[model samples]
Target chain A: MASGIAFGVVYLVYQPFNAWITEVFKGPALPVTIVTFIFCIVVSLLTPPSTHTEEERVALVMAERNQEKTASVR
Target chain B: MVSGQYAVLFVIGFFVYIGLMILIAYMTSKKGTTQGEDYLMGGRNVGLLLLICTAAATAVGTGTSVGATANGFRDGWLGAVYPLANAIGLVTVAFCFSHVRKHKFRTLCEELQFYYDGSPYMRKFMSVVIFIVSIVWVGSAINGGANYLAYLIGMDMIPAKIITVLAFGVYVFVGGYMAVVWTDAIQAVLLFGGFVTIAILAIPAAGGFDNIRAAYEAAGNPGAMTAFGVGSKGVLGVLAVALASYYGAMAGPTAHMRVYTAKSPQTARKAILIAAAVVGCFSILPAIVGMSGFTIASNTGAESVLANPDFTFAYMATTVFPPAIGLVCLIAGLSAIMSSADSDAIAGVTTFLTDVYALIFKKPVEDKDIPKYSRIILVIMLVGAFGMTIFANDIMSYINNVIGSFTPGMAVALLVGRFWKRTT
Candidate 1:
């Protein structure tokens, strides 16, 4: 979700910014790279850390499998 | 049109590349076990480098290379928005869904099934959707490659497409996902190198960057020099295309398989980041080449490639570089198509076997039978894709319409299912 929002923000800004840079500054790459870097940083900051650890994920998978097996038996 | 000598070089180069891909497939097939998991997902142990290359290659296919360059020829910088958006979307996938790599799901539908409390309905629906999408994707890839082959070698479109499809199908049928990955890695290099070489050679041939801009201005299309260009579809259109391209990269079955096949979540995440950077850089090259082609045509009083922008890359390939380098560019364009075709073929077959056939019939194939069944399914899917190509007259528009219509719904479903606690 954060990534999606970040992409939206970047898309909204980048188009006009890219045009301005290309027309006035005659440089597209510098502005694009800068905007991309900023967008990535913002997205990384906004995205919450992973909720489940590796062990928790494995345990969850196992539990789901066991539940499926029980349901099938029923 | 390409000269006879260059056509010969292109054919030789193409066949040699195909032979190497087949050899790689054969070698990989011999070393691996023939289990369904191994064939379909590379045993879910793909490393970072291979993942990066395969994902990048799959995303940066004929659409981004030849198609985008052609658009650039007509629309200028606006033509690059699709790939630029794709690169951003890839990074978004890494940031948002890298943890999916930890799961052992074989197809996107399997993930959907798990999210929907094991309900098979969503799986069935998504399976059919992805299957059709993958087949269409394969056809588009063939269509793009055939255009290059037809233009470069003067072969008719159908025969060129047949040969292109067959070349990729043989390798995928023989080696499965592993072959696809290894070949994608090689093709990624060829694609990147080919485009970069053309862009470099084209600058001088078009009489430098300044001259190209001057010519574009002189042609009474000064807006083409701007970032938005004359073709900058309104803000909503831009956003829609961006989102569609993003969804295509993130939620599409081929890309979903890439996530599933990664060795680990961290590996997938890292690979996505690297691939995003590579794709972002590679996306601009086609635009550069296309813009150069436009400039060349304007300056030389040659026939405009604008009448069919899809031929812009091919026009430049034949006209801008030496015969040897031009041959490499043709092969690179072919590689772009093959890389996508092979990946989509594997994804389509995997979806059919696991999500559609297995779930609908409740009949799982034995491990010993996987390789044979996979080959059979791959062939059927390729043939089906080929048949569809006959009806798909405009490759880019067809792809865009399908993706634009379907992806937003898929993206919403994926986001809701993944993060919304009440989705089920």
Candidate 2:
């Protein structure tokens, strides 16, 4: 949600856009959400998984697959 | 048609309708839900119909109904964009987060921590943000309900705000989340019926669909007749509104709570899908209702309506519909606001009691004390939020600001943390 918060801060900070700018991009939120979303991923790739996160991912994915398999079988 | 002439009827009708909701809440609940699960999640056994109704009702809330009506007044068919966004959000939730129910998370924070592999930093920081977002959302709901009430009854905003908060507050305190879902079901019926009834009656009242187009073009807002809003809010503007809505819906504390409240993963997923379809249909009503209000306003040159289009929903109801029909219609408008408010309030209180309060004081709340603490926190938070509403300029702005300010950080965090592994 940092994307939203950052947009809010920018929106509250000033009306930076002319009418054309706002009409075109909706005041930086799209770009912000896109940027932060990507930024988080890049930063994440640079770091290690949280302790046991891989294990958590394994269980989570397993449960999801099992549920799908159960549904299909039934 | 004058508001003062119908004040008594409106008051009586509103209270009676509130009474019906309370009755529904009482009947649906069992011995007032003393258990934490029952109080917080309606025993997490919410059936499909109840889940769909509550989810739709919550999704509609102030922004989708009152705010959209106001939007429709100015922008025409573009008002449908708001509910359209909600539909998208619900569908996304159903698919992306369908498996969350299996984990049985009490708060989004727990899910966050799990996503981060038991990391406590994000959870501790985001809890306070989640609680504040709930208050801001409830605050906006109060503001939304009060806006229409003030115009409909010619009452001061302070009194209107108090009535709006208390109307939902009492029942929620008594019956907890069960009451919220039950009341929401009743409200979903009224909210749809009222908007549709007004839309049906209003088209003819304003002379017809052709007249609506003619009047809008005559007012120099040719964009008002088009779905994409050609004027100031063009295609991109509409998309901006949708993106903001999607973000809010994805991370809204109350929406998260409801997802967890569902009986199962399949049920939650199905309920949200149904809610999306229902809201998709409901979007058209506001487009018609708001356009009708604009048609009437342009014809009559009602300065009150022109100056404050937010009041157009109630203004149209009070002036256009017959007295009895109008009274129920206005209550439904208030219900649209309260459905969201009460759930968010309960969700906030439960989160605070279970997450924040426990985190602060270093112990889980006693099982016996959960009910008492929940009520106390609800009162405190509502009062604080009520105070905030008195100063808000408009429901749309209040909702957008409050939601936009806090939700993106958590929403992005959840997406990144849950789906990605290397986040330590």
Model 1's alpha-carbon lDDT is 0.74
- Candidate 2 lDDT over residue span B1-424, tens digit each: 2445588888888899888877776775566554765788777777889999999999988888877888888888878888888888888788887687877777776667667765555566667877877888788788777777777767798998898888898888778888999899999888888888888898999899999999888988888787646463777778777777777777677667778889998999999899989998988888788889999998998898888888878888888889878876787788899889998898888778766875688666766777788889999998888877766546536555645644555667777776766764
Please write out the lDDT profile of model 1 over residues B26-58, one tens digit for every residue.
Answer: 988997834666988898889999999998998
Candidate 1: misplaced stretches above 4 Å?
Answer: A1-74, B228-232, B391-400
Cα displacement (angstroms), candidate 2, residue B182, comes to 0.8
What is each candidate's fraction of native interface contacts (fnat)?
0.00, 0.46
Q: Which 10 successive residues of model 2 chain B have the least lDDT summed? A: B393-402
Q: After superposition, how far is residue B160 of candidate 1 from its true place, in Å?
A: 1.2
Best by DockQ: 2
lDDT of 1 by residue, A19-72 (tens): 554455343222333443454445435655434434443443333322333233
| Cα RMSD, each candidate | 7.9, 5.4
Q: Which stretches of candidate 2 lie over 4 Å from their true place?
A: A1-4, A14-24, A53-74, B230-232, B390-402
